[model samples]
Target: MDSARPTPGLHEALAYLDSLRAGDLAPQADVPEDDEDASYDTLDALVDQQDAKPTLRPSPDEALTAIAIMRLCHAAESAGPDLLCPRPGLLSLLFVSSHEDRNRVARRHPDLWRRLSLPFPALMIEDPLGRVGAAKDFHARLAGRLLSGNGVLAIVSGMAQLPPELETLVTARATLPPITRRMLALILEYLHPGHDVDLPISENQLGKLAPVALAPVLAAETLDTALTQLRRLEDVARSPNGGPGLDDVYGQPEAVDALRQVVSDLDAWRAGTLPWREVTKSFLLTGPPGTGKTMLAEALARSAGITLVKTSYSDVQKAGHQGDALKALNAAAEQAKTGSPSVFFIDEIDSFYNRNQSSNGYILGMVNGLLTLIDALSATEGVVLVAATNDRARVDPAIVRPGRFDRHIRVGRPIRSGITAMLSAAVADVIPGPDLDRVSEQLVGLSGAEVTALLREARTAARKAGRDLALEDLQAAADRVQPQLGDALMRRIALHEAAHVVAGHAVGLPAATLARISPRGGEVVRPHLNAMTARDIKGMIAAVLAGREAEDIFFGDVTSGAGAGSNSDLAQATSLGIRAECAFAFGPSLSWISPDTPPTLLPTEVRNRVEARLQAGQEEARKIIVQHRGAVERIAAALLEHRELDGAALAGLLDGVEVQADGAVQHVGGHDA
Candidate 1:
């Protein structure tokens, strides 16, 4: 056999077995004790009990392996006295318990067991465990039985460790034709009471869906059972405070619009005005942590007057195996479908797959199963599949494709006005005065959830001091609960943002606003320039670099605050600097270069010129700060006090301070020379 071809099936099965036996799961999960009573009735009763309680069962892989082994045994029986691969008799049952379980099974079905082993070979493998010599002898006998096509074997063990010869047998069996759909259906019929119920498994879907051995636990006499468990249909009517609606979701207009669009699509589909194919059901929500994605999802469902089916990674993992997880997913889909116009949500969808990397068998199975469930859900009208992730780039690309998760919506960080609104809504008892606006301004880049949490913490702080919610309480809590970049780091960040404001004023950059700087980071918002002259680009680059230059001038050394690489102001500055030099031919030579031209493609002299341009921009910013050192100090002082200042406020402060080259101070009438 070629060494290169991947045997993913074999590896997956092996991984599944290993997972069942790993860590705390081994003793507590799949293993049965050796001293258990030898009664098939007890074992059968236990199986029935487990079937009814899905939470207390082994993974679906065990049942899948058992079925595969049984199919292989049947194949050997049909081969009729000439099987190349080693095979057990017509009734070789791998019980995955102890020798006692095998004996009990034989006792339970005495007639069939006796007939199958009428002419029993000298030593058929009975127990999964025996002496090394006994195991060797059993394999030899098993080979002879396969040659003669007459014998019976039973393998029962709690240990997932397969004997070496048995492992080989399983590998060989993988080459055989898979079990037929008729055979699978028969197995399902024998296992459960309902004959008309739909199973999630099929030949086309076998790779995706696992046959859930514990599915009976979720079975409902009516579809409402599944709907009730997974989809909370009654939540719409049970809302408190004048009932929950879309208004509960704050700072996510785009997400709200998208959800409203989902409701519209559902309405259109139900009215037969929209084609089934045109129905937009699935959506992906992307944002940073604490952006109110979950609240948005719940509010969407609540506002639509429908149920919300919510599931998570931990919930699926608790299902124990592929089959059980698939069953859980199927159950959710079924419930969502049954509860028409419902929202089916998968929180932290990025957790389901390894991005651009090979995932283990369980994750692969989960990804495939979820994809299948999402596809199957299309037939069910008014069921919108919503998945949220903090990092969309970390999710599997296949999941977010057009037909799977058709729409992608973002829940962004809350702005000042949004934060103010959130604060106002959060505070009911105590009144916020002028400092409310100041606090809101300071919370520039916080998420909606974070804003709420900040207020909650503030209230708690105020209550501890036996006082009403005060501005000082809010300020202290904001500082305490905010993500800390350290006090020294905050000083550095303040200087950095202050430099941008001063540079923007000095260099005539348009509409530049210095937003708040928390311990986490800060932002400088500027109006989008429809077009940029070479001077404007250079000025912007200078403003971007002003932070680093300020640190160098004041602190004598710059931290990574300005240039922590990707997505940083320095990174943006460098990118724009390169574009100005190469792409736009804005360099001294005035020669048009390809926009895609890389820095490495530039002539050595041109590269030097690009570096010179960036340095000059940096020097220009330093000169402005030097000329307006008094203004710089004033702006930085005000920023430290308020945590933020708009472009207009900054311009006002700078306009009031004037510095001559001779260091004489005078008041100026207008902002920026």
Candidate 2:
């Protein structure tokens, strides 16, 4: 209703008007009247002659004037139509239409319209389903005639399906210049829906959006600025290598060397000065659990002044499609290329390279994808790959070849000195004494993780009681924990062990540590001899099993506790003795082909050989037991009385009670004498 309200097609109509005015050189034109006007007036008069005439009639001039007046009134009541005008050397508007009569001003200005170029330029028409077939035909005809130079033909439509020719034109390189920067910004905004336009787009953010486009831009930057920013981020992430140096990592000097080498290579590779002819871009860290593989990887990345992208196989496998998984991996790799050095850590890499026959092809495909990605990444500068695995043997051999993972570092259990230092560092606040030393000595074969668990237990015990951790707490914790081998097993183990010691002594092999059986921890049979012939080892094993078998044969039934025999004890003894004879080449009979070198021993053969040797040792062991039954009984009785006895107590009980080979005993000590 408002005259000031611009019609929907105002811009197009105005553009048309401007184009018409520019082309016409003539100035003005007056309104023309003729016989048609007179007829229209006459018809109007006739119609007025009778209010209800059989036929309606009006004077021609009057009728025409009335129609003109109605049109003018309608035009005045509604917002006037927009004028489409073209400006020379600028954009133009073509079509202008609206529902209002006021918008049809062009009909009154026929002369003006005739001179105007009708096909508009830089105007978009919504043509869903290409229904504007005639409109398009009209534009093509006009374009062939009056349209000059390069002009934008914008089409707005809900349906994006365009003719092949139009699509080709829209996407052509030459068409790019006519596309206004504003249009480009709009297209980008539309494509990336919901992205805040005003937010700062950093290298990190750009890398997230389209890493393919952003990675090269970042890589071209100066190294110092890139490294500094990355280091700052690392600090924020609280990464271990956030600081200037690598002094925080404990023990593992060899592992430290390997890490240093990796960092050095990564730096050189980034700087385009690597020395190795074919150095692997990736390193594999394999070891027992909790040996700091993950921590070391992070620290290595941090030290190189790179962002670390850690991913597990489980994360990739969850993506469903192999392509999707690879895309994720590649995206992560690209993200790390943000003008800085980056480490891409693939943890539990064995999962991706599982060599199990039952993996059903999925693993192979994953491995192939990873291999391709790794190869592509290796050729790239400023990116380092570090993979870790607990079971290195389970990984496919192809993944561990020379160039893929050139550096293989093994992290084993901590030795005695390492353990001691670890304890000193971890438990410095806790008071330690002879008990701690003794406990440490007993924990020789434990892995680093196990030792840490022990330490944690000790600390927890002390904390629960609201006191400083003491040696007693550690000792008590140790006592409560049983060894992998049980006590009854250990006694059979000890007698079996004592057999080894006795045989070793008889065979001129050095005696093992005094064979004292105790339930405190399993029978710890430490051979005093550093080395022995295969024959001597076999004799010792035979003796050990002989002791257990002798007790079984002589006593008819073995005891259940420590100092007797059980199924577990028999199994251990017999197995070891067989290994000594059949596997160790310690059997009495020697052949050109050593038993140790057998391709494979059938289970039946192994069982028969072990049984035969065990029976012989049992017979010999029974004779010895019979000769010293009194001394043996005395020791067993004393052990029952005290419920615990050291090596000295057992030795004292046997002192001066001489049992000769003739089975005669003479007491030479106080009570027995």
Candidate 3:
């Protein structure tokens, strides 16, 4: 073969040889040809002889033959049966050696002399372009050969972008061999300009890839799936063609309205009617647990006809390498992008924000990356990002600020109407006469999730007994599932809650629901009466402190529900009280100074102040509970008998009680008279 004008086929063979050089078993320098050797001279003469054969107007079969020959020779040279190329027909024996060995042999002997060492002469072609042209022509012929049942051909391409020629080749008139068309659609969503693509993988795929990928990707995939499931549920929530509005949710008009606003914005954006900048694109659904924060997010995705991507914080954190995790996340986003107009949901976003001080700074970087991704997606078309968190207080405030997350909607527990709706819907099928009114009354302070669970329990009982569900079943279920606050606790809680009610009512704070206790954690539906002014909060603290002081005077020691270790309740009351005195100016001692103007309290100081106020409140709570011992017993007895009572029931029991001027009751440890 002419070195300067090696055939295109030869070049391909050489390139293949060069690739092997980088690996083991690379060929040594070409062995020098012996001019005196008659076999070598004869082979050289034959090679030069073929070069003059009018180039044989190369046919497609000839081209394929050349490629096949090159492949065989290359493989043989790399490793061997030590066989020389006797002729084109003998190339079949070359398969006995590995392809690498064949390539090595061809590299060592690039001329016809190597062939003369065999039994026969093999034709040689000199032109380079002719060789490429021949290769292309050979491929085309191979397409025909494949159609003629000589072999099989497989074409892989993006979804809906299959090559026309290949398609035609497969569908040709000739009897084609079994050919498989594999569609490998890869959708890359550009969440940010420089950010990697976010490929949304299904839950099943997620399970497969997460083990190999980084933590962030796993987190993103998990969140995406959860959100997607929620979205589907939301779609099922509505009547056909926007028929009737959803009636399952009740009482929280504010929450409902906020959700509606988000949905409206999402719809407008989807319809291409809203300005990109003005789109209510992102939201931070924050509130007490069991609220429909997660549900609402799903509902929004469903209504908008989008796939939801749910991610977990723990999964993201567990990703060993930051880059790996990021890549996984990007892949998921990209996957979601394939199905445009998708929702990317990240649950427990606080995990990323509240990285431990010991975390080797990876979390902070991840958070920044997430922020960038979210911001980018917000600006991009056809994608929505929704992050849900219960502990908004712990979330990095920067994330919830203007650009990252513009909408901060508090997803609080269901109100009376909401409870009624939730109960009615939950028990609609099982309860013969579903008294939502009664159920709602009994379910005071219960969350959406709790109500759902209650219904599920009732249904389970009915199924176990082999009977249809009845109100009795629900009531029985309710009996077994005690509220977070029991009778004993409620009596104490009643006095405690009563103090807040009376104090707030007395101080002209908004007249709202009286204190009612439940067994479930986070039962206080609306913890705050209103946005507390500095003065109002101060007065409330004084009342709490005074109640504690009164409790100490009347009962001697603090009660379980009223004193220390009541983390949730105490935290609430103390935090409020402290803020009132120190931050809100509700206390006389700290009213002169603007708490806002001062630097925020150190954690230690805040804890100290909270503890101090809690102690004071404990003393007052003891006195108040003791002074109203009769009323307390009445409420407690009622609670024990009924298992639960609404604010109205407790108030009715206290109707005959006389109040002292100091917001105290007259009776002590006696039955109501």
Winning candidate number (TM-score): 3
**Candidate 2: C-alpha lDDT:** 0.45
- RMSD values, in order shown: 18.2, 27.0, 22.3
Candidate 1, 1-673: lDDT as tens digits: 1224332233333333343445222221221345232223344323332332333223433434433434434534444432322244432423222222243233323222222333332223232222223334555555555456543343423112235654444322111223333334433443333654343332322211123412331343343343342233123233312434676665566677778877666555544367547867778888777878788878877666566889987787787677777666655665564344568899999888653455478888788777766775654445678888986645787887777877777666765666776777766346554667767766767888777778888889889999888778888877776734566777777777778777766776654544557667776665445356687777777878888888888889987766775668777777777778766778777776643456788788877877887888899889877767777677777876777676678768778543223321122212111
Q: Write the per-residue lDDT of candidate 3 for residues 103-191, one digit (tens) a residue.
A: 32233333322322343222121111112133234335434534444322211111111235544433211110100000000110111
Clashes of each: 2, 37, 68
Every model's TM-score? 0.45, 0.40, 0.49
RMSD value for candidate 3: 22.3
C-alpha lDDT of all candidate models, in order = 0.57, 0.45, 0.46
Worst 10-residue lDDT window for candidate 3 reads 176-185
> Where in model 3 is the C-alpha error above 4 Å?
1-252, 335-338, 355-360, 429-434, 483-492, 501-516, 519-558, 563-566, 572-673
Model 1 lowest lDDT segment of ten: 664-673
Highest lDDT against the true fold, candidate: 1
Q: lDDT for model 1, on a 0 to 1 scale?
A: 0.57
Model 1: CA > 4 A from native: 1-244, 264-280, 461-472, 482-516, 523-556, 560-673
